[model samples]
Target: MKVEQIYTKCLAQGAYYIFSEGEAAIIDPLRETQPYIEKLEQDRAKLKYIFETHFHADFVSGHLDLSEKTGASIIYGPTAQPDFEAIIAEDNQIFEIGKIKIKVLHTPGHTLESATYLLIDENGKESAIFSGDTLFLGDVGRPDLAQKATNLTQEELAGMLYDSLYNKIIPLPDDITVYPAHGAGSACGKNMQKETIDTLGNQKRTNYALNQPDKEHFVVAVLDGLTPPPKYFGMNVSMNKKGYKSFHEVIKESYRALSPEQFENLATTESIVILDTREANVFKDGFIPNSINIGLKGSFAPWVGSILVNVQTPILLVCDKDTEREAITRLSRVGFDNVWGFLEDGIQSWKEAGKDLDKINRITAEEFAEEFTPDAVVVDVRKPSEYATEHVEGAYLKPLSDFEEWVKTVDKDKPFYIHCAGGYRSMIAASILKYNGITDFKEVDGGFGQIKKTKVPTTDFVCPSKL
Candidate 1:
């Protein structure tokens, strides 16, 4: 038997592939389907089933495309009614794959359809359970996301979660391994561990949610500090449930390459967004006017999902040569598949053509401290938690997730100094600010990380004094 956890770090998501005796199963695949298809071909196995934990809100699942491509049956747990055809499995149902059996344990409350798949080895020993959002290593999936679907309050879902964990998961043997769907960075759970895979015994001991005082306290603990999910989450969930365009079709439609003039013409004609996927430093030096710089080097998909609320928003790319496909793929992973084309030959071609360009003013943290004045406006573009923990004195919080809304309050005529924990987010902020006609601002070179190291006054709650 062979089992592999196919982890994608950018989304902090994990998909599983299990195979034995020429039969294979895929659990919660991403939007891209080629990798899974190729895996089966390489393993000399046939895909028999595609298991979906629930209607995911973080990213689009590849279940539909994989089913259509490989003729595999898609399976979901009880209470799931997808727009596409799928087997609505029962609470204790079991399916055979090769030499092993996959027992479906209906573990709802992450969503009513959430299921944990127990892999029983050929010898009939329980090997591992793929505990999809129902149970994370140190946390559990948030209860709020299910309110819209079940018309049940988060508290009700949390109660259901309590029952599910106690009855379905906690009763399992301690020796079995637990592989959860997401890790720390994911919005699915409030306090997930960085580790994706852990043993059931260790989790019972270490996980806060697993050792709650009671169901009432568990509900309160889990529901306490969940920030609003990204603007694209609901849209992605709808796409997952109602069905979406094929990944192949999205790729085919998005692969067009246009010359600089043609790209400019299309951008102007359609009023489509220009997304520059270059390094933050390169983007800051010079970029296409009004293009939003979300570097491909970081958590590109989640950032795009946060800033661009509409998944179907038409986008044009100004990416480095040969990187267009990657940018398009990452965008598609987050359900943004309407990429019209990319700038051919990169920004150099446009530069050579004498096209107009825009640049953001940036300064090193030390330099910013030296040039600082009493009334100078400073913006901390990190999350509220980050800012509240510690930030430069007098820096107003403007988290990048809600850049569009928070930025409205910034004076149109006055310049502001903006920074994130590091340079990446601030560069993204600068690009968006430029796009929205708020260009008179400077980006702190290394963000608060460097600013805190300088003599600049930084504090939490109330700033005490300038260092």
Candidate 2:
């Protein structure tokens, strides 16, 4: 028997592949399905099932396409009213894959249809539980995402989550491995551990949510500090539930190579966005005018999902030549299937074609330190938690996560200095600021990371309530 956790770092999502004897099953796959198909072929295993814990809001799952192509039965837990054909397994229903068994433990908290699949090894032991969003290593899934679908309040869902954990999950074997669908950096859960895999015993002992046996305390502990989920979440969930264009089709449409001239023409003529996926530093030096820079390096899909807002926005890409497919894939992961094409040969082709480029005015952290004044506006774009930890003295807090509201109240004409933890987020802020007609700002090149190294005044002061 082989169990593999195929983890995607950018989305912080994990898909599982379980195989034994001659059959295999995939649990909670990502947008692209070719990798799983190839895996089955290589292992000489018959694809038997495509199992989904719930309709994912963050990324479109490949269950539909995988089932269609492989003739595998798509399985969902009880109460799943999917538009497409699927076997809605009953609570505690068991399915056999070769010599092993997978038992469904209906644990709905993150969403109404959520379930954790328990893998009973060939030895008939509860070896691991693919906990889905029901349980993370250090946290439980946020219960707010399903309010619209279930007409249930977040508080009510939190109560259900507490019951799910306490009654269904906590009773599992101590040595059973726990594999959650998402890890840290995912909005699915608040404060998830960085580690993707952990034993149930360790989670029971260490996870804060598990420590609180009382339902009231558990609900509050799970719901605390959860900001609103990204706007595209519901849209992604809809696509996952209804149906979507094949990954093959989306990739074919988006991975086209457009010459610099063609790329410029499309950007100007159509209502398309030119997304620059180059490094933030490289983008600051040169980029297509008005192109948004959410580098492919860090939280690219989620940032694109949040910052871009409209998933239907037509998009063109400026990527490192060989990475066009990667850029296309990440955009599709967040349900941005309208991506048209990529800048052929990257920024070099644009330069070779003698097209005009726009650049940001960036100053080093040391320069920002030396030129700072108490009256001058400085915006720190990190999270509130990061700000509370320590930030430059007098830096007005405006996190990039809530940029839409923050940008509205800012004085457009006022010149300010913006910095995030690193330069990546600040550059993203710069592009959005430009789009909103506020461009009189300088980005601190190395951001607060370098700013902390300078002689800038810093503080760890927190509000009285948090204290």
Candidate 3:
């Protein structure tokens, strides 16, 4: 038996390809099915099964598309409510192909229908378990995702997770390998280990979730530090369950490259969403007016998922020529396929076309201190946990993710200055404000790092140094 791990860095997701003899099964595929198809074709393997551990909330899954294309059976746990054709996998249901045995284990904590699949060699020795989101290398899935309207509270869900971990997963042999769906930077769980795969023994020894003495403490530990889910989570979950629209079916609408004059005209004619994929600092220094800044620096897809609602809405791309493919690919990962082509030569093209550009005010920490007044509202746009750590004194904490709500509570007319840990997120927050017509604002040049270097009376809260 041969096992291959396919990692999609854009979505921070992984899919597995298992081959026994000439038959293959794909587990938890992403929306883009081309890569898997190409692999199977090259290997000369018949596609037999497409398995979904659960309906993913973070991104769309490609179970339906692969099944439709390859005439493969779509399989999920008994409680799953997939809209397309699928077989309900029963607990301990075993299937064999070539030299491998696939056994389904119904592990429901991350979601009601979540399953962990065990792979065994022909000799009956367990090799690895596709643990899905129920268990990760260092952390467990956050229990709040599927409990929005359910009778189960966060505590109840976490308690279920403890059982799923201790009762179902922990009993597996120490040397059995564990492969999960998501890795670091995934909102599916807090503190996911940077490594993609780990042994059950390693995790049992070092994983904090597993080290907890009892279920009650374990429940509190996992539930306490979770960030709020992205706005598009529910939409993605529902879309995945209903079977995501196939990527092949997405029509590539032809769009003419806009001349500078035409681009300006479109911007003025109606509200056009301009997505600038440059670094945050560059965007803050100068950019086209009314553009929503989503830098390619970190987790661009999830942030785009949070702000964008209409996938069909026209988007004008503003990126360096070298990053065009990356920009398009990342957007497509989240099903944002309405890219109306890129600027012919990127921002340089627009500048050469003699279009008017806008500049955002930026000030250094020392300069900001000189201009500081009690009336000036200083906002920190980092995460709440980051804010709880060292932050500028007297600055109101409004993380970039929750900036929309925080903006409403502040007096828009007041002079405002914003900064993140680095300068990056501050630019994003500034762009968001500018897009909403909050014009009188400035972003700190070096952000908190620069501010901390200077002598200042600030309260420091303990947090992980890596962040």
Candidate 4:
């Protein structure tokens, strides 16, 4: 029994390719299926099955496309309502592909249709389980996402989750490696382990979800820390059910280079999307107008996957010359293969081309303190809990997740200053402001941490000031 884990970093997703004898099976494939196709061809294995753990809401799945291309059957739990032809998998249903025996286990908590696949070797012993979102390395899937419309509350689903974890996942042998569909930065699970794979034994000892036997407490704990789902989640989920758009037959070769004038023309014509992969502060200082800012600092792939869905859209990358390959590889992880080209010499190329650049206004903590006025709106773009723990006096709490809608709530004419825990999110917030036509905005140079470090005078808006 040979198994390979295909990690798609852009979506924080992992798919399994199981090969034995002359057959191959893929579990939880991403929207782009070419990589899998190339792998199968290279291995000389005929594709036999494509499985989806659930109707994913985070990123589009590629089961349908693979099935269409390879004449392979698509498999999902019975409760799943995928539009294309699919085998309704049931508990204990066994199937054979080459030398591997696959068994499906219904694990319903992440969604109504979630399932875990147990792989048995030709010798009849369990080898691994593709846990999908039901069980991650360090965290269990969040129950709130798929429960929004159903009569079942998060509490009710969490109870089901407890049963599934204790009854099905726990009873398996400790050595059976648990391969989840997602990892860190995935919205499906909070506090997901950074590692892509872990054994059941390790997860049992270290994962908080597995340690808690008290169902009530477990339910409360998992439900409490979930971040808001991305704005594109609903559209992605709906499209997945109907199946994704067809993958183009022609794979365009990635652009090797582009002159600054050519890049500027592409941006102006809206023929290509400019991706600034520089540090957030660098981007905030100055960037080409209308470019989307996704810094290379943290979770670059998942955030890019969340915001940019059109895989074929031509991309113009802007990064320091040193980080260009890192940017390309990150984009490739999410299957964004239609890169038109990268800016030559990065932003310096634009300077040489004499292209116009836009700069975001930034102010120091001391300057913000002196200019602070009731009418000058201050926005906190950190997490809600962070804002609650500490914040500038009278500043409106508008998390970066809530930024777009939050912008509407504020008076557009009022000048605004934005800050987060540090400078990263402030720059993101600033770029979002620029895109939304909010120009009279100043981002705090060092963010809230700097404000605290400088001991700038701040009144407590939520609590009385100590000083």
Q: Judged by TM-score, which candidate is best? A: 2
Instruction: Write candidate 2's Cα lDDT for 1-467 as tens digits.
Output: 99999999999999999999989999999989999989999999999998999999999899988998899999998899888999999999999999999999999888889999999999999999999899999989999999999999999999998999999999998999998999999988868889999999999999989999599988887888888898989999999889899999998887799988788889985667889999988898898888999999999999999988788999989998688899888898889999888888899999999999888889999999898877778899987777877888888998898997989888878899999988989999998887677878999998888988888888865662362
Candidate 3 on 166-244: residue-level lDDT in tens?
A: 8888999999999999898787887788899889999999888999999888987888778888877787787777755
Per-residue accuracy of model 1 over 1-467 as CA lDDT, tens digit each? 99899999989999999999999999999999999989999999999999999989999999999999999999999999999899999988999999999999999898999999999999999989998999998999998898987899999999999999989899999999998999988988867888989999999999888899899989988887678888899999899999999988998999998988898888885558999999998998889998999999889999999988899899999888899999999999889999999999899999998999899999999999997886889998897767767888888888888889877776889977999988999999998888888978899998898998888888855441221
Query: Each model's TM-score?
Result: 0.96, 0.97, 0.90, 0.78
List RMSD in Å for every model shown.
2.8, 1.8, 2.9, 5.3
Candidate 2 wrong stretches, greater than 4 Å: 461-467
Residue 325 lDDT in candidate 1: 93
- What C-alpha lDDT does candidate 4 achieve relative to the native structure? 0.79
Prediction 1 global C-alpha lDDT: 0.90
Model 3: residues with Cα > 4 Å off, grouped in runs? 148-151, 254-256, 265-272, 309-314, 364-376, 465-467
Let me know the TM-score candidate 4 reaches against the reference structure: 0.78
**CA lDDT, every prediction?**
0.90, 0.90, 0.80, 0.79
- In model 1, the runs with Cα more than 4 Å from the true position are 460-467
